[model samples]
Target: MGDGSLRRIAALARQDARLLARDPAPLIVRTLMPLLVMGFTQPLFRAALRAGDVPDANGAEQGVPGMAVVFLFLLVNVVGFAMFREHGWHTWDRLRAGPARSFELVAGHVLVALAAALAQLAVVLGVGGALSGLRVRGSWPALAVVGVPLALCVVMAGMALVALCRSISQLTVAANLLALLLAGLGGALTPLSVLPDWARPLAPGVPSYWAMRGFSTVVLDGGGVVDVLLPAAVLCGFAAGLTVVTLVFFRSAHPKLTWS
Candidate 1:
């Protein structure tokens, strides 16, 4: 890409960041809601971990990271909503007619979403630890290894949804369904060791499972960067696959509608 194109994506990313800042309620709410939920569920998580043979395990070890992963996946929908809102506001064509390519437009959204997702993860983990005793117990760099790839997966998944969905309603339903389904199947809702035998095999297919794997290794087992490499690589594979799907299905001229 040329310097000019880079500049355009940067400019659009800045604009999108500003727009996101303008409506911080969703971000604030997601952040606070997880903390509140952990308050009520940490004991339960601790009990489950104890039952799993980690007799000394505090609930925060499971509660904090699990809830963070769930919310992180939930936040993926924001990317789709942001992109679809352009069409709702009748601005997508105008933006399309501008100098930026469709790829650049989507790139801008991806950049913003990636940043927001990372920040959200950091905030949730940090505060949850401070308030709920969720310690890292391992390498901070290892945490980043898991977090960055997970964030990339989220943005790519959002882009894929935007490519596939034609209406706001469809996008909303798909994004939410995928978020919940992926989180639940991936063992974010409960530990993989505790899941029924038939469902245990399905967790590895979802990005959230790798994320939780990396996180649990760090937060619960004191594992370092080396321990997380496999999960990180798997997350990158998921992100790459989603990117291919988005590229294959997305078209600059595709029309989007706000279902009434």
Candidate 2:
């Protein structure tokens, strides 16, 4: 909107970034855990491919990209805690008392989360490729198209959680459940084709499902940017819809009470 508001959001985002960097738990959970999971699964994926059992996946490619989708849920939970962290530290009022509006504060969290999610996804893919000998076999930019939307969706969803839940525990429980349920139903835990008949139709509805499909199109099919455009558009829609919902929820909420 206004230049002042833009400046404010940027400054606040920087502050939020500092706070996030200082937090070790989010670092371990968001950054390290996904890499660890991918590393552990690489051997299994390699074996499956050799046996001609893991359909549509060649060695570490499937398992590695798969981890990116799975960790998105975890990223949402980690980013969603930003509001609670401020609330716990009793800094929300201070921000609100100054030039910051609730939107400003929420936007800052969104910015930080967005950047973090993108970086986190890259780390997972990078570690998979470097340490586990994973290959892209397709356009790197195409993969980024999938990643951008996934990151946006997580950030928007996390901001919504900040508005909806009152306490860190409440937010954590709800976000984790949501992340896990989406992962389970959306083919992050397994392939969509392998899912039961009844679940097939529903799998397409989840954001992560689109992410997996897009990734597979690029990595497994050796498809290009044009092929991934559909899933990229789908993910963008999810991000936009979640953004609207987050705005509405955060706007209607009185931050002082919501934070409490």
Best candidate (score: TM-score): 1
**What TM-score, over all chains together, does every model reach?**
0.97, 0.90
Candidate 2 has its poorest 10 consecutive residues by lDDT at 251-260
Query: What's the lDDT of the predicted structure labeled candidate 2?
Result: 0.77
Best by lDDT: 1
lDDT of 2 by residue, 109-183 (tens): 788888888888888877766776766778988998888888898888887777777667778788889888788
What local distance difference test score does each model get?
A: 0.89, 0.77
Which regions of candidate 2 are displaced past 4 Å? 43-58, 251-260
TM-score of candidate 2 relative to the true fold:
0.90
On a 0 to 100 scale, what is the lDDT of residue 184 in model 2?
74
Q: Residues 191-247, candidate 1: write the lDDT tens digits.
A: 867977887988899999999999999987899999999999999999999999998
Off by over 4 Å in 1: none
